[model samples]
Target chain A: MPHDHHDHPHALLPPEPALRVKALETILCDKGLIDPAALEEIIDTYQNKIGPQNGARVVAKAWMDPDFKRALLQDATEVVRDLGYYGRQGEHMVVVENTAEQHNMVVCTLCSCYPWPLLGIPPGWYKSDAYRARAVREPRKVLAEFGVTLPPDTSVRVWDSTAEVRYLVLPMRPEGTEGWTEDQLVALVSRDSMIGTGLALAAASVIEGVEASNQSVEGTAE
Target chain B: MSRVHDMGGRFGDGAVLPEPQDGPVFATEWHARALAVTLACGSLGQWNIDTSRHARERLSPKDYSRFSYYEKWISALADLLVETGVLTLEDLEQAAERAKDQAGGSEEIQKSHPLSSRRLLPEQVAAVLAKGGPADRQEGPVARFQPGQKVRTRRLSDSALVNGGHTRLPNYAAGAVGHIERYHGNHVLPDSAAHGLGEAPEPLYAVRFAASELWAHPEHPGDQVVLDLWQSYLLPEEVA
Candidate 1:
């Protein structure tokens, strides 16, 4: 079904942006500087193949295999590549694990640099001036705003991604999911959890989050 | 030059509103195209990612804040295209005029001009994604500091006077004392790479700075911030 602008009057983006993008694309394509098909391919890869699901798979696998987790912690790029998640913004990977005494959070204060291959695109908030500025100064307050309240004893270690190396947070595996399969465990890993803004969903709450996300998906699909 | 892009330890930007967990990859069609164009041009190897970021940062602060994320990309793309001689302003103007005419015409007008160049095929996309750009230099200057070594970030009295180039070091972290957490090996220094300078690869380290060191008041005294600092940005802590 084609998206009719008239039908969805409240579309967040106006028509001007689309027109401007089309103009730029036309110019670049006309000059033999870019191939429209190539552009589409890149977009499709990020939209479909590369996303939080890939990161979730890695997290779940790490939880199930101690050796893999060790490798991931020591050298993330090689381990992630072994699982076929390696590309731009993810070439130099660093996985910071969250423990009972210390929590890990990732932020790019300079720019919105994220692990694109593993986590697809960064969310809007991650790129916002608010998160970029306050994440370093008052991470506990920022995390609390994301509904990620930590215990007073557990110190927050904010990883400011200031260089080429990309950082990913390895949230501790939730309790009571000891026997869960990798696939089931993947369902508990949300994008925010990996960013350290939120915690991994517990086994019981995973269903509710999944259902809520499904509803949001349906809403956007229309 | 203490650009707005170096936004660490600053305050009062507003609340980070949470979007739906499952949101569209792109908010609009143009955003996808903008991203594609940027990546497509990027694959040409004409410029590195650091250069592209510097192009965006070169924009005036007002223009930088006014444009949406992808708009910044498009603006930088245009500048890069012109600067690299890939496209001319006249060519873009003509194309814009043609696009305007096509928008008013029938669908056939849009289908008339087909892309002629070799498109980045699906197979090529896979290869490109697989062959990531690792900035680490195989052999370079040996690392100066080891883990657990105390260090302080070099403070530039006037950042504008520091070669007038973009730097990865945040203003907030400058002059702050920290402990070297790990040596991340040699990587291209972005301060040089962003300005068409040769890849002066240097050893980088993950430096751990206490929250109290960076801020006056403490939200959590136990908190700490770790930054990946390039070799050029650091100096050995002065002995008493």
Candidate 2:
């Protein structure tokens, strides 16, 4: 019944459920049932209404447009601005490009330094000690668990970002976007692309079929 | 309060010592109040704090696993404030109430406020950067060690150092001898120091390791692992 897609234990400590919990516990701890529901409602509104889906749209656009991609690599803050994702923690950002020679992975070895503007709140796993410790020590091994196996010998540099300078991962543009329109390409991008895992959704022929379903919506509108 | 991975003691030439935990952060009354204050003030994103590449001691490992990263920052910040008497627990509760009120009934909730009434001007961020100079520090001795010159990862086993307990300095490349590949510029002090430990603006170096050197993969023996390491972490071949 939690509003978020996943019930992560290490939810960012403030601004959503944590804040709601603190507020409710203070004002409505005695009225437990009523307080919890309100807290849940607040969390759900943010998660479903205004979180990762917003990030997914940016990922999709970058995949389809070269100019946007260039803008993203050169200056993520400006590029994300074009898409309209600007705010607090996301105020400054640099999208690190993942290349064949070098792979860029993000970790806030200090804390969870995330691209909240582009990716929403970080998941529980990101804040876990396991991810934090292993990320800097054995990046390739940990990545393999996510099904991303880097070629042995590719210099995997793990970046530990802070609030002053945050980072977003720009997964390589997937194959099969060729001949696809910008709108179609956007459909192929997903939140995972921004995290350096799972290829763009369109790379799978199965996703191409879903593309047809999307086309129908456009067809009906026309 | 120590981070688990601050195993700077084992790898480098240093002694190991036992570290103790303090207490459950949220379990007690005074502690909970402090936690609440940190959460509220931190939510606003008013101040900047990060300990990435410094050479300072970190909290005990057990303490680290106990709290989330931001929780750690909040704890560190609050503890520093309380230690310095910047704010009191009573002030925190009052502030939280005020923050909650501002948050409600406001169409646009601003997560940040100026830490001080006198806000920094636009040029301040740039000025800070210019004053801080380059993020990367200058090159050092390893530059003296060429591609073919021999070098070994020095064993720095200082239990107090964050990355020192098991193997501080560079974890993977420790104790391994590799030829110098290139000299990277020096960077601002490593996290260990910045957090409150070692020297500042430490020089860094990059060395190349064969795939077989790091991992014995005959199939990919030709592969190479080029790593950027701080100069203090390395010892010249002549010394070893």
Candidate 3:
């Protein structure tokens, strides 16, 4: 309420959710159950300190190191925690690698149970009602919406996160980047690929330059 | 039977529309605050993630379908605070009233809160994040299902559904036969843990079901949906 507004945000209507949330914060803070400073720190930690970049690093390392990849596939909790990405929602980790024969995807039918230590807070779509419903029913169609179309012969394996074990998909590394460094390959990884909606960016596709080219593949920049 | 939140294979929700992948993680400040407060309260040790999840599943279908992500979270969080004895309904109403205005009420309310000093300080954030609340328990009952074994999921009784008990079993896979893919050792069972019955750690398995068996018409016939199911929900599928 301290911030004055004449109502012009989100179709000129009141941001009731925002106001109600503020009220809830006030109540919790007044009751001494939560600290205002700690709240800010929590937001900052998720916003800047933790996110997809952590997962990108893990994936890049997995793609580069065979032993590490084996470690990740066999036991992601120990391997991922070794890289310092360990926390709630990702306490028990499982990495499913996408291969030529099988394409892996994940969804939490009951709720959005994502690997937070590596991926941070899930995006809006991951928690959408549409996604929670249809992802399991028709994952191929859902993947198509994300601009990813697998071959007819490829098996679309959809992992519904139902238990404590969280998942991170190790998307197959893009071709034509034979000797790229870990940091360079990190840029090729998008958030969706780890969740199994899209693939890693094409090595020479876009981002640094979005100029029209015949090689502009799906999941390339933007 | 299923609660409103368990929407696995059920269709008709329409197309998936995600915000741009490169966009900001959170849309608004309130959403951020909502998330932060939830984490802070969660760190208080009074409740676990399953308890918070059960709060949402118990919501009426109308509210579950209508409320936005954070709206559902905030509502559930409020009920948790009261249920855990951290605050009362009156306490929430009064604070919400104060939030409506920047007047002198907040200063007085803070002084009156008996547990005020027990707040999670900024310095503790790093340690808390590092040492998260892990659900895995080393010791539990022996494994009942092994990999490659055919198992069928048992449905929840109508009473379990009506009573609003918490369970990890989704409705879509109910009574569906699947092959055990892997054994995930023992972990805290959400069903008993959510209601303060006990952690009741049990053996878990990843059961893989063919799309054909789960859906009347799967878009991709060869596709598979794998679910991590607790042993209690599974029964040995005798060869027929």
Candidate 4:
């Protein structure tokens, strides 16, 4: 009954968001319930140290090194951990490869259970209501939304991360990437490709992207 | 079965729009704090991930829709803390009240106490992050279903469906037929764990259901939905 005027019918609202979190963090820190520096460490870890690049490195190595690919496909968790790309939300890794015969995609319809250690935080689209609700039911339609259209004959397999096991889609290396170094192949791997919502960039597109950037640099110099 | 948060194939939410390439890990300060604090609090081991998830799942349907993603996380954090006796409502209220007028909280405020082993330290963060929480346990019961075996999802009784503790089984796949694609070994069953029934490790398998089996007159012809389902959620697909 703090505020209940006839004209203003709404209940009193809580403090602003930043203040609310600040209040919670303030209390928690005050009680030694949480370490402030640990909070900063987590933010830095996910924001900087971990991300799609780690996954790209894995995929690129798979594309270049057969033995590494075999290990990743066989025991992703140990293989990924050995490569130093293992952590929370990524404890149990199941990497499904995309092939000419079948395309693989990953989604968590009930909640956002993603591979945090490799892919960082999920992109908004992957976590969207549309993607979660429709991806399992109408995957091709969802893929079309992401601008990926597979041939009719190619089977599409969508992995729903319903348990502790997290999935990473090993998108097929695009054609014309022959004799490419692991570093060069890494440049072609998009985050969506690893999520199965999109395909890896074609070799031509990566070359074009490089050329386009160079052109921009030259234009700026002029 | 009709839980507000168990939205899998149900429609009318909206279209899936694309985010610009390489978005920020967190969009706001509150978001980062929400994520960090939730994880930090969970590190205290007061509750398991499933229990924390249940705290979020059992949120009022109205509030579930009203709250944003991180908002839900913060709300769940409060619920978890209060439910686990880590903090009182009065403590939360007093903190909010004291923070309302302040432009920004200062570091000088002292409520210093010795940190527990459960509390994550700054230096331990890296090793902790690298060494993630592994839910996989030693082999429990013998595996029932094997890879490539035809199986159908168990149709939970209406009571079990609505009991609503916490479950990894998505509503859309109930009673649907699929084939076991791979064996993921024994892992914690969230249904039991979330309700304090213990880890109750169970053999898990990736069951691949054709999208057509999940939906009628399917939108996509050959697409398949592979779900990591516990052995308990499955039954042998009896030959017709």
Give all TM-scores, in the order shown. Answer: 0.89, 0.51, 0.91, 0.93
Candidate 4, residue B4: lDDT:
76
Ten residues in sequence with the least summed lDDT for candidate 4 chain B: B156-165
User: Candidate 2 residues A1-222, lDDT tens each?
Assistant: 232212221121233334523532332222221223333333332344435555667666676678987877777766777676765456566676767776766665545557665665566556555665555545565666666676766566555442235566666667766776666665555555565543455467647678887999999999
Best-fitting candidate, scored by TM-score: 4
What is the Cα-based lDDT of residue B137 in candidate 4? 88
Least accurate stretch of 10 residues (summed lDDT) in model 2 chain B? B13-22
lDDT of 3 by residue, B32-79 (tens): 998998888876778888899988776557767988998788777776
Error of 1 at A163 (Å): 1.0
lDDT of 3: 0.83
* DockQ for the candidates, in order: 0.39, 0.09, 0.44, 0.53
Error of 2 at B50 (Å): 4.6
> Which ranges in model 1 have alpha carbons more than 4 Å from their true place?
A1-16, A207-222, B102-122, B157-162
- Per residue, candidate 2 scores C-alpha lDDT tens digits across B1-240 of 234443211222221111111122233333333333332333223332333221112433443556554445444553333333343444334434643675553233232322322222223322322222124435323244555666776654232345433222434445677777544445544444444553355555556555455443322334444445555666787745
Best-matching candidate per lDDT = 3
Tell me which of candidates 1 and 3 scores higher on DockQ.
3
Q: What class would a CAPRI assessor give candidate 3's docking? A: acceptable
RMSD of each: 6.6, 12.1, 5.9, 3.8
Flag clash pairs in model 4: none
Rank list by TM-score? 4, 3, 1, 2
